[model samples]
Target: MSFFTSNRFQDRQAAAAEARKAMAEKFLSRPKYDPNDPAVKEREAKRRAVLEARAAREVERERRRAEAAAAEAARLAAEEAARIEAVRQEALARDAAENARRAEEERLEYERKLDRDARYAARKERKKKAKSPFERYR
Candidate 1:
């Protein structure tokens, strides 16, 4: 005894073929798409608008980033210039102090030399006057 009345191999093959044809007919019965449909045009327009908005936003973001980078570079350059100026001023001040010290030393040395020469001249004049009045007649 079997569950099906006609459990023959030919009967099973015929039933399977009918089922496949029915499935293919069902798949082919749906309406085809039309490119000229208003709904499709509206969807495409919406997608284009979204893409444009996204591109505008990206351009604005890039502009802001470039401005920020330029500002940072300017700030760093200003800081470096200030630092260099400070170093230059300090060096000039140190050189001025050294020159002043040198000038003072040279002035003191000149005065000492002058004083020694004057003392030697006065002693020679005194020795010459002590013997000159009598030695001239001889």
Candidate 2:
């Protein structure tokens, strides 16, 4: 088993060395370019222009997205403010109605008390009149 394992490791190392050699040869065989060549310069300029255009488009898109977000936020804030104002108005109206009801109840109670006092006074006056002259002398 040990011998087989050592043999497998050596085989893997040999294969890796062969792969590196092949990669190096392939890289060297690729076409070389001259920096001063007009074709090379043109290709570089085209690539740079494309990259700049893409960046500009991205910036514009981001600006529009930010504007949209701000508009949405403002709209939501306005809606919330309107809702709050409506609630406040409703509360005020409720309070006014409650006050009116209380006032009406107090007025009714006062009127009933006045009626009872008048009836009591009339009864007392009748009793005094019913007493005769003899009762008054006693």
Candidate 3:
């Protein structure tokens, strides 16, 4: 038989026997991993660190964006409130000025009526006096 054929038969039979023995073993054993392999544990650690840094940076960026949005909303609310307050104050001032003007006009009309009534009463009394004394003498 050729060397390769002889080796393949032997390897297969041995592999079968080993698999059966492993199944019958009381406790299973884990395969040995190389601790000192150049691209093994170091590469995994670097990849994990990169993922963690990216996660932290994303969280920080989201927090800043949220803060900026909140500040902008607050500023807009304050501006709207100030504008409403200014409008209210202007309306109140206008109402007060109109009330004062109306009151002054009513006072002037009352004074004119009182003066006209007094003049009319005095003229009637003078006419009565002149007629009474002169007609009796004649």
Best by TM-score: 2
Predictions: Cα RMSD each? 9.3, 4.3, 11.3
Better of 1 and 2 by lDDT: 2
Worst 10 residues of 1 by lDDT: 128-137
Name the better of 1 and 2 by TM-score: 2
Off by over 4 Å in 1: 1-33, 115-138
lDDT of each: 0.93, 0.95, 0.87
* lDDT for predicted candidate 3 compared with the true structure: 0.87
Q: Write the per-residue lDDT of candidate 2 for residues 1-138, one digit (tens) a residue.
A: 676655677899999999999999999997799889898999999999999999999999999999999999999999999999999999999999999999999999999999999999999999878879888789
As a TM-score, model 1 comes out at: 0.56
Question: TM-score for model 2?
Answer: 0.72
Name the candidate, 1 or 3, with the larger lDDT value: 1
Model 1 lDDT per residue over 1-138, tens place: 688587899999999999999999999996577778898889899999999999999999999999999999999999999999999999999999999999999999999999999999999988877767678789
Cα shift from native, residue 67, model 2 (Å): 1.7
How many clashes in each candidate?
0, 0, 0
Compute each candidate's TM-score over C-alphas.
Answer: 0.56, 0.72, 0.55
